[model samples]
Target: MEDIPNYVAATFIAIVIAVLGFIYYAVNTATPGKKNLTSSLVVTILVGWIFFVCVQTFNGYFTNLSGIPRLPMFVGLTIVSIIILFIWPRTRAILMEMPITTLHYIHIVRVPVEMVLWWLAVSRAIPMDMTFEGSNLDIISGISAPFAAVFMVGSRSKSRIGATIWNLIALALLYNIVKTAIGYMPYYFTPTGGEVANLGVFYFPYVLLPTFIVPAVLFSHLVSLYQLIFKKDQPQF
Candidate 1:
């Protein structure tokens, strides 16, 4: 981790902020009447989660490979929270009504995220497989996000189907990188790169990837999918 340049970490932190800002914007836009309450709630919850994860990481909770793995547990809680938000009527409505452009454009952050991953890989903080040079093809999704937003910006049936397909493909890419990351954790699986154990993620800044960035990206896809498949009329840009 020490070998990683300061710029990489700075870039990553910027990405995290960008993601959080986008989420706040999306929530605020979706629920205009309750924008203040909902936006504040979203920011508070996300900021609190990030702080908690940082404290845990500083305490060596996630780094301690001895007992049950804390990293997976932490990620599981996030997943469950997302599921609840999707199923809860009020929150679900916000998600369903969020602008499709918001969902699509937010993914642009993934481009810099992938670059940060590549930098980490170069520093040997993580395995190469987690970057574009290896198995993680998620950068493609980031690159195409703007075009996807423009291409699907109407109520056309074909556009909706096309957008749905793009979302699924992007979701699968996300899953692939996440799975690859888990396989390199020191809890159960052996490190993919002999000595590198994907431990950077258990540290500050990087911890934000699992707790905030990934979840935000995942939720965006889910919201977009729900809007495309279930909502009768798609929101225009």
Candidate 2:
């Protein structure tokens, strides 16, 4: 909070606008009966805002990995998960009626979570390795990022492959920009370093891109393309 001037006020205003905008979008685009856009918009904003303002607050440093403020995050997620459980007819019907597959679950969580993370990345609160500590945490994405790609390919969907591939390629391009901003790699690493650990290298997260995030994004889209070709846009009843 100290890092921000009047953090609470700024946060409140930002949230209000976002909520209003979401409501407008939902009201304008929601289908007539299936799920009211108004309601969906409310739920989405509630869940999303809670995650943004309460749950995932540590300035976006995933490595801060601390545990003090995660309750809001968990609670918001629980609420949203419950809503998904109830509203998604096909997925809901599957339970005993059938069974929702891992892929189904993935879409429910991944889509929102990734979108949020992306937003945070854009917001400096998350930091783009603007500092040493930040770069380190950012690197974690290097390993975990690829899982997104793996999931895309493994899902075996065809119709959506093109979209996913497009997304992956976009991520790669964005990652390079971020890496450069961080002063890592050929772009700039080791702003200062000595006695680097054996393999003790530390260009920090900025330089770790080749490691995780790059490929995950790349793979997700590639997988999407595959789906576009050989699979259905969504699951069959």
Judging by TM-score against the true structure, name the best candidate: 1
Candidate 1 pairs with clashing backbones: none
Candidate 1 local distance difference test against the native: 0.86
lDDT (Cα) of model 2: 0.35
Against the true structure, what is each candidate's TM-score?
A: 0.94, 0.31
What lDDT would each prediction earn against the true structure?
A: 0.86, 0.35
lDDT of 1 by residue, 1-237 (tens): 788899998999999889888888888898899738989898998899898898998898888888888888888898999999988998898888787788899999999999999999888888888899999999999999988887775343248778888999999999999999998887756753366768778887898898778988998998888888788853442
Highest lDDT model number: 1
Q: Where does candidate 2 stray beyond 4 Å? A: 6-16, 23-28, 33-41, 44-87, 90-161, 169-237
Q: What local lDDT does model 1 show for residue 206?
A: 94
Tens-digit lDDT string for candidate 2 (32-146) = 4545554565557544644454333335532342554232233345446545644786433322221112222222222332333333334323333422233323333333334
RMSD of each: 2.1, 12.8
> Which sections of candidate 1 miss by over 4 Å?
154-158, 191-195, 235-237
Please give the RMSD of candidate 1 to the true structure.
2.1
- Against the correct fold, how does model 2 do in TM-score? 0.31
